[model samples]
Target: MGRVEPSLFSSTSDPGIDQANRPDPRAFWVVTFAFVLTVTSFGKYEISRLTPLFFYPVTIGTLYGVSARALLRKAFFALPFVLLVGLFNPLLDRQVLLEIGGYSLSGGWVSFFSITMRSMLAVTSAILLAMTTPFDRLCLGLEKMRVPRVLVTQLQFLHRYMFLLRGEALRMVRAHDLRAQGNKPRIALSTAGSMIGLLLLRALDRATRVHRAMLVRGFDGEVRVLHPLRFSWSRDGGFALGWILYFVLVRLVNLPEWLFGWVVGR
Candidate 1:
């Protein structure tokens, strides 16, 4: 699963649309599966062949109401690790595959490019799914899709508490800064290490308190959603079929090549 950098609680521009706006969360699931399958099929193609395929999701995501800026920013989350993974490819794969004038390019560079493009496409589409569907609702959707209760339950709790732990850590940092030298503020490396341990201790204490409170109120380790999961054959079924068909067509035909050919056939 890809991580998104945006705030989960931030509302989109259209307040009228939300996780429950559509009758079925499966609509999003269908779209996700189609996109993933399409990307996977591109594995057999090289850089030039797969380049345009990657951009298709960007267009789809934008049409689905995800802003271009958000897509790019979220896509960048996987970039550093992707860069690290491909860093040695150019060095190790030195077989010259292309020559332009005096400059020669190796297979390593081509493979690295392909890897980077795939990474960006995968991460961006995953982020788009998150942006379109609320996390809790997605978990419920997963549960509906027969995903294991334990996995969904853990994911729900982790998402719920990440913010709590972040807030606590920030408060600790603020207090430490206040007590330190104002003009030339700096913490000793040993002190910094101790603060990290202190942060974990504080997080644990907070978690225990929250758990006790939940138990006092009769929490049975189940997070409940207020709305019922609705499914309509007319809406959700057609929606699923439409997007899945589009993905299938794109997978079978080189859409970019076809479109280019169509444009030039005057």
Candidate 2:
């Protein structure tokens, strides 16, 4: 049978074996933490400097068998919010900072561009993290890295149970569709509120039963993984160290300028 597509919030869509060749989730977590820290550390107008940081997401995507196009497409959904946040930058900071090809560039526009680039990098990093690591493994990694147990447990439960909530919603919508009047199938605003209330009650009832089932199955508030994670020094350590070194180098060096000068024999 073909692979069954999962719900939006469901993360175990694919088998964990798919990530076999991938680095340990904890290693990915470390690098992601460092990557975000480095990307956001750049100044407001340092968009050019941030270009090299794109290498992290691109490289990680490639390594994890995710295409650059897919990563960018996923990251694109977050840009509108970022744009909204930076919308007033150009209007408020009109002081010209430089001229490029006779076109004056204001500090506001420069900062706006910088903000957008940073946001894209950050979002891309996060998307890559989610793409490469399964939700269960990610929570395990977080717990290993000293993240609070309560938070990790909550996240685990949220991811595991979101599919149940989605199924309940889908059933309700389907039932509504079957009962509604002919042709244009739509939920009336008047009925939507009641439907939502009904969904909430159904969700609570479902959650209670699921919790009882889990308790019967020996769920003692501890998340369990089918395949326990083991940190490999040669593999995981090398992967993290290599990326960390590259990030540090990129942060301290003007790579584009250096490449240009080298090409020109300067």
Candidate 3:
């Protein structure tokens, strides 16, 4: 019998490592500013003001080749949680706080709407960051920010193994297909059970192999990355200053309401 070929799915790895090289400190600063502003905006319940914050990351991601659709899909996963909390707003807080000609609205309704909007903004910003920043560099950034080395190492391992697990799973599926040639597959509990068992077995084997490879390469459960992170003065300074200005303008200054009024007028 012909040797079972490596699964075609195994060949399809994550996109190229073009994003792995450390981003310019300027780029990192832009992302950091966007992240802090976005998170802080969400925390303060500044719904309308947060809309402008999306532009930074979206612009960066667009330039950096991150998929908009994929980022939005990640945002979609949070919808249920947002809705669950938001639904209570209209029901619990029934007192009318504002009157616009004839429409009456409650504080709860306003708060809820603000929460939902900010939630979407926050989640989208996070997704954009993850998409544009390679996971390893992100961990390095965290390490630089004083995140514990243990946590960073765990994150690095998880990201690397996730891709490996995906490849292994694909190989198992292809092997099953090859073995089941000309047989009508039964869609039943028994078949499902067998498939799960086979998948687990193959996954364990792959993990063992990966662990051995790591040990051979002198991995003592600590990842030693080659490029040590270096902060650039001009780029990082400019980036930080931009974020400081943004925070001052958006939070400290009264810009959001004015911007909202202008948009509505237009």
Candidate 4:
């Protein structure tokens, strides 16, 4: 069976809104705050306390229409890298640190737990940001935040052509499927070579056509984006205040320990 396409919801039906609306600065700040919080949370060696931090981004992403399954899948992809790093924590430090339920665990185990939790938070926060923000807007936001012009231009170009390349690949796959008559041929060395050659030729032709089109439209090196980003005082202020309060409450106060301990103890 073919893979089911996800049901995507947008805030507006207008094409302009769907394709190129300016992202709210408030949302951007909130996402940024979550990212900073996630990173700071990892610097500590406490696993139990870090559990509460997950709820921030989880709630934000869920409310913002980011696919939870997609986020989890991305998180899982990064899991092996995280686990590999955590694995060394157990091997390098072998001191008994804690005892629970008649079993004594090493300090390495505690360190490993903290490392894993940190990795999860980092990965999840990144995935959440990517899911909520469109690529072009993200680049634009970075540019607004004073990133180098060269880097921003490079990112925009890369993102634009990556989509083009993926579309080309999809077309090639569909053409191959049509020609194969329901037989899925394993890509051997010879077939792979021929496919690569064909794809390169097609890509070159497409690039030529795109260049011609650009020339026809008065081609310039600089890409002009019409929708300029504007900062709203109220939105930005409210967003900043909310995150500041959250950070103070979560990190500065011992609320997690007090709340969780009371509930568990009760």
Highest-lDDT candidate = 2
Residue-level lDDT tens digits of model 3 in 1-266: 11111111122214553433435533564656556654565543345666666666677557656566766766899999987877887788788877879998787787788877777776776665565555666677777777789998887766656667776767766776676646764435777688778777777787789889899999886776786666766655666666557655666555678977899999
Report the lDDT tens digits of candidate 1 across residue range 1-266: 12233325332123445544453766778677777767766752256656556555666655556668767876777899978878888999889988989998898988788778776776776777777666766788888898888898888777757756777888987888888987666777999899889888888888788789988988897767676678788877887787778777777777778888999985
Pairs that collide in candidate 2 are: none
Ranking by TM-score: 2, 1, 4, 3
For candidate 4, list the clashing residue pairs, or say none. Answer: none
Cα RMSD to the true fold for all candidates: 3.9, 2.7, 6.5, 4.6
Model 4, stretches more than 4 Å misplaced?
1-30, 37-41, 178-185, 189-212, 215-219, 261-266
Clash count, one per candidate: 0, 0, 0, 0
Worst 10 residues of 3 by lDDT: 1-10
Q: Which stretches of candidate 1 lie over 4 Å from their true place?
A: 1-17, 20-23, 54-56, 100-102, 182-188
How far does residue 66 in candidate 2 sit from its true spot (Å)? 1.4
lDDT of each: 0.72, 0.83, 0.64, 0.65
lDDT of 4: 0.65
Off by over 4 Å in 2: 1-8, 11-13, 178-186
Candidate 2 lDDT score at position 27? 95
Give the per-residue lDDT of model 4 (tens digit) for 1-266. Answer: 10111111211122322423334543564656565664565543577767767776677666665567766876898999988988877788888888899898888889888888877887777666555555555666677777787887777666555555656777877777777654784565787788878887777777678768878898665555766666665665566566566755666656678997899999
User: Which 10 consecutive residues of model 4 have the lowest summed lDDT?
Assistant: 1-10
